[model samples]
Target: MKRLISTLMIFAFALALFGECALVFEKYTTDTRIKPITREMIAAQIRIEEKLSEQTTVNTGEPHKSTPSRQDNGAWMLTLVNDKNPLPDAYKPILKSLSNGLQFDRRAIEQLNSMLSDARAQGLSPVVCSA
Candidate 1:
């Protein structure tokens, strides 16, 4: 009977602590006064940002053409791959495996190694989990 009572007491204490933590989390993480944003508001913000970016862009008086085979410098790093700007179906990146068994693009392997070396020099145990 005593054991059961003590177990019940512990369970009740844990439940109360969880509830208190949830309440505290909600109190600090949420603001109820702000109105929900509409799609029009987001679209307007995007337009404003686009206008700002266009104003800041400097044109070098040459039409920009995408080059595929040039991997000399970090020029290839500007290639953007996303859902809207998907890579060519036949496109394949030259991958180089690191010492820790993770593979990354060969073009940026030097930069990646330099970053890892810098991290290690700063006494950080930086392990590349994925490439």
Candidate 2:
């Protein structure tokens, strides 16, 4: 009888240990779903963040140079135009007509003409292929 009681006590202890482990495992398990990420998604997210950062203003004690509201008086030179910084809808650059019947930004016309003249003088036969 004594030996039988000892055997039953050991079985009960083993069962309790196994039950506790099962409870612990279940408690730690997660049911949340994880989605896979792609390179294009990361690139697009980065581009969006960069554009948002460009539009946001930083608070500095000193006065900061503000972006020009209009692209006038050669202000376009200092303006940044890229994937992150886009041209304003109201911006209309000054246009000038070239001798070759081409229109370009007035600010750049002088430099473009100078370069063409120099190339011609050097006998390079420079041609305006595309604007």
Candidate 3:
């Protein structure tokens, strides 16, 4: 009976402590005016901005020069390679190995490096699993 009473006393103490903590938390949250922005929310915003940028052309001061489309430069980069669209047996790309031993297409290595560096500059750790 004594052990039962002690356990009950401990549980009651813990319950009271928890109630105090909850009250403190409620007061702190209610007093705050700022809302938290999550990484997922920021990523969603980045995706929306990317879509909008793709549809609009930037105003560079120089006259517009017609450059060949990406397809004309490197059609292989645009190839759809998934379960539904498998690559042909004869298809072979000129690959280059990165410093960390990951391989990507030689044609896009410069652009990929630039993108990775840019992302790093903006405080994002990007991991490229595949090209």
Q: After superposition, how far is residue 110 of candidate 1 from its true place, in Å?
A: 1.1
Candidate 2's error at 82, in angstroms? Answer: 1.0
Model 3, 1-131: lDDT tens digits are 99999999999999999999999999998876777899999999999999899779687889865443334455666865665556656878899998688999899999999999999999999999876
Give the candidate number with the greatest TM-score.
1
Q: Runs in model 2 with CA error above 4 Å?
A: 1-75
What's the TM-score of each model vs. the native?
Answer: 0.44, 0.41, 0.39
Which is superior by lDDT, 1 or 2? 1
Highest-scoring model, lDDT: 1
lDDT of 2 at 88: 70
lDDT of 2 by residue, 6-117 (tens): 9999999999999999998876675356446899899999999999997896767787555645455766578777645668779788888887877889888999999999
RMSD of each: 12.4, 17.7, 14.7
Error of 1 at 100 (Å): 1.2
Candidate 2 RMSD to the correct structure: 17.7
lDDT of 1 by residue, 1-131 (tens): 99999999999999999999999999867978876899999999999999999999989999766544434475767766665566778988999999988899998899999999999999998989989
> Candidate 1: how large is its RMSD?
12.4
Count clashes in each candidate, considering only residues at least 3 apart in sequence or on different chains: 0, 0, 0
